[model samples]
Target: MNERSLVFFVIVLLCAGFMALSSFEMVQDYIKPASGRSVILNHLMKLTVALVFFVVFLYTDHRMLFSRPVIVGGYVLSIALLVVVLILPGGETRTHRWMNLGYFSFQPSELVKIYTILFLAWYVEKNQLFMKRLFRGFLKPLLLVSPFLFLILVEPDFSTFALLFLTVMLTLYVAETRGVYVLTFFSIALIFFVYTYRMGMLNNILRSYQIERLVSYLKGNVSEQVMRAVEAIRSGGTVGKGMVLGEEKLFVPVVTSDFILAIVGEELGYIGLGVILFSFYGLVHSLVKVVSRMQPIPSVKTFISGFAILIMLQVMVNVGVVSGIFPVTGVTLPLVSYGGSSLLATMIGFGIVGNMILESERE
Candidate 1:
């Protein structure tokens, strides 16, 4: 398997997602009159734009893009976007998670994830010899990334922050940072978590609904949304009820974004879900093979590996939430999710990876 094969799987997943969303849109039509512009149409437009980004990144040289000055600028821009989202008005879900642009809303946290990985790849490569040291290898990198994590946490996006932090640590580990240092940082993070819990800071940080979701999950009590999702999936059985025919998806909250898999299960059945999972597996497998072959190019290898980890982490959390195994974390299902920010960021990451693959092949 190669980059082409990896991208082919992505397209398959994308098409599957579109079919699910189209089915959802058809379901919605039964209850309401057709609006001038529908969500599916808007999503299509965003998908078109996202494809442009993917192509641009695929053709562009990643080395030029990840140069010290360019990566630094992008890192600074990402931080500024994160800060702006917090300070600006008209955020989503009463949280500072989205920056409302005049035309459309943007999720700064998503962009920050990409830039953080890119910046880290550059930083790690520059300090490869010092990666095993406490300061240069671990502490400095952690400190540098702390602001991004802290700002995201303040946005009260605990899920994204947690996952992003984990991804960063994984990147550092892959870059040969001291394992003990990473472990020590985890210990400190754990202690901080305990302190925050004891101080009731968690409540202050997370919204009431978010806390409720977490508590419900911890107590083995699934929320109505998850319940509906599970029911929808189970009803699909071996083969789905049929495309656009499943009624249960209508009851699942955020069906097009978070619980889209439930729709896949309900409409296309186990086969569709299996194909989606297999495509994702293929994507990660291809990425791992690419990383292994890029041993001579440590920076590219690390960045791609980190990106792969991010995708897998989101997939697990999203699937777990839908299946009642984890709390609702508002994580999108990569290419399948309906969010423009996630789609654009993911496409850009893939394009960069594709470029790296071509470059490596040329060598």
Candidate 2:
């Protein structure tokens, strides 16, 4: 692996360690709603799955993903799962984001995120010459990505949708698609949004809670959950309440998952938050540095850019939500969140990234 990638790997492990320790602290306090062996086993499973994926992708030939059939099949399979996930019960009707596997739930959206990145990178690299064309280049890829996106939005996963949008947009931008096409595309999207609202499509599509969150954000008020997050952050002051000493940890709902950043802020204070943010920043910075320093193929450079942006965007979204900067999103803090699917997906992303560097070194 390249020097930059190796440094990032170390940072990822450190972040994972910090998250694991913090999660255990929550477990001891009984902050999570679930109980018994499930929680413990689930945590163990994330680590186990992460190890397996990272090892395979890191050591093995990364070229498997470049196979067009593999890319197309993976994309199709992920989309199919997204469709199936929607069919599964969410709470009242069917599940939105995950498929229950008895012992633990599997989030197909997580897998889709990685696949989307790979698909765009592969598609862009192959269609580089034709990319500047309007329909053949821009519109076709948009159409291809839209079905998966539509399914995700139908699942009402706004956060994941946001990530997907960024990944595709960054990929196109890196591919040097024309500014006019990008602008026209956004303009058309705005028109589509208006049409959807006019036809009551947006209303039917967006969930009640999602609408509430959006309204709440516009009005500068948030749900009680974020209120608790604000309180937790305030209580931590600077140096933190000292890990397990954080009395406020239990109050914030989903403190072990979505709002875990608040836990870090409250338990370890700004110092801990600094470490978390710094680690993410360093990784993103290193990826950017790698892209700048190393002369890789255009596709590889775009892959690095898109991948780094995905990490940076997710981190910002999660941190921004917990800190009350952005509207609430289901985005997790990557390796720092106690989520098996998210953790595994993140590992897959990094492992592929490392493999890209490995291939470059061989070249």
Candidate 3:
């Protein structure tokens, strides 16, 4: 990374850490003492784990993961975890997105998302010569990625599933997959999605709350959470209510997770939000520059491009939901959200990207 890019990343990381601390303080009143866990403690533990992943990936050889066996193993392991989460009993919300261990909960969809990107990149590079062919290039890649998407969709993680699917398609396009074939596949998929929704097939898969949320969004009946989030942001005006001083945050549920931006808006105002937006743009711009200038390693370039897309997509979705432009997709802001699974996965991907960039520069 260049000096300027490093500065941008550090700014966002510091901002995220500060916001997380403030969020922890805000939620303390609601956390039960009998629960044996504190929000701050969980955030710190997860941040520690994320930092460890960052260091490990930074030092490790990126080529190790480029091996066929290693890529396949990682992909299979992600799939297995996704499947296991479905069979295990869900927590109080009855959402099958998490696997509750004794001390921590892991969201398998997060793992699946990163692994799928790596796997697709490797697969496309390995078959680049035949990538224009219908079966060998287009259909086959989609077929391989289908299981991962299906598992995540069944986990009822629609946002992750959709974003992952989009990322996979983008990777293929970057690796020289035929544009016609890719477009045809996307068209067919869209038709299938609409057909299923009309037939009520999706009703069986989506949870009651998920269905209700979508319906409310479609019918113009915005949910209370979204209303509160918008209200909080609008109430901030030009200057914020000041850090930890906003009364609106008290009414917004999931303020620390999906709607964390609302807190940023309310506490820090437009200046804080503008800083975050610029920082994200800088980070992604830096990554894209690295990908574009790197030596002709299709897999590495594709992976980094997909990673950038993933980050931007999540940020946009989170912002949209908070502003009531989009429905609540339960998508958290990249690096800004309060979940261990999300933070760890993003850091690990960053580590891989850093290693690849360094390796390319050395070559």
Candidate 4:
């Protein structure tokens, strides 16, 4: 690999290493009581899956794969998968976010985020002049996005839907779409949000337990879920409780996924949390640098900026949820969270970013 690719690979490896260590710590604390060897193996298997996907994505030709037809096909496939997920039985706590295949579960909404970015990029590149117009150019992208958004909401995966919406908005803004057009879109979204909530659409779409989780969060009741997360962070204190010493791991729901930040806060403490945040900031900085240097290719630059903002926004939202600054939305902590699909999707996104940087460098 070239120096740039090597640097990108190193960063990805560091992220994976951190997540694996956290997962191991959780397993030792929670699962070891019943079967230590089995717990270790399970965590190792997850780590292996993530690593394998990362390696595969690193070797793939991102530029060729992100072509218009492939991007559109990906969107169609993602929607079909989302439909399949909705039809599948035994989703986590009644949330239709995954399709279980005995050995593993796949979340189609994660893949939707990727295809949305690709499609928007292609759309803006082809309609650069039209993009300067207000409604004809700007609002038209929403027509394509609306169906995906509607499908996600129907699946009752509000958190992912929200993230996806925000990502598209950011992409449009960076693509130089009119600001007033975005404001108008936002107004419409707000109206939809109010209408959905008032008409009990969320309740009809989401499971009762899922609704309860959101209610508990909004009420600040500190449900068993929230308390466990708090205990985990508290245990970390200044330095940390040390790996595998966290008491909260056994009780924290989705400890390896949405709640992974709590484990990191507990095991690595405030300093470790700082380091994690710093690494994310550094990654965003690198993306911005790439954008600045690739001014000649405005389309690519816009895409990179949009992608970076979207990823960083998710990271920030995840941290906020864990820190109690925002209601828990079940959003994974990007690379730090467990799950094969999430890891693979995120790595693919980063690979595309790397490709943009490489293409800029070649020019």
Per TM-score, the best of the predicted structures is 1
**Model 4: per-residue lDDT, tens digit, 5-87?**
43564465356546645555556655555433453355457657766765665566666665777877777887788888778
The pairs that clash in candidate 2 are: 88-94, 88-95, 89-94, 89-95, 90-94, 90-95
TM-score of 2: 0.90
Question: What would the per-residue lDDT of candidate 2 be over residues 113-231, giving only the tens digit for each residue?
Answer: 88887788788778888888887678888888888888988888877886888678767867777878887777887798778756767668788777678768868997788889888
TM-score of each model, in listed order: 0.96, 0.90, 0.93, 0.87
**Higher-TM-score candidate of 2 and 4:** 2
RMSD of each: 1.6, 2.7, 2.3, 3.3
Off by over 4 Å in 1: 34-36, 90-93
Clashes of 3: 0
Error of 3 at 52 (Å): 0.3
Candidate 2 residue-wise lDDT at 325: 86
Writing each residue's lDDT as its tens digit, candidate 3 over 265-329 gives 78778887887878788888888888878888878887888888888888788888887888888
How many clashes (backbone atoms < 3 Å, residues ≥3 apart in a chain or on different chains) does model 1 have?
1
Candidate 4: misplaced stretches above 4 Å?
Answer: 1-32, 35-63, 90-92, 199-201
**CA lDDT of each prediction against the hidden true structure:** 0.88, 0.77, 0.81, 0.72
- Predicted structure with the largest lDDT when compared to the true one: 1
Higher TM-score: candidate 1 or 3?
Answer: 1
Our tally of clashes for model 4 stands at 0
With candidate 2 superimposed using the best TM-score fit, by how many Å does residue 201's alpha carbon deviate from the native? 4.6
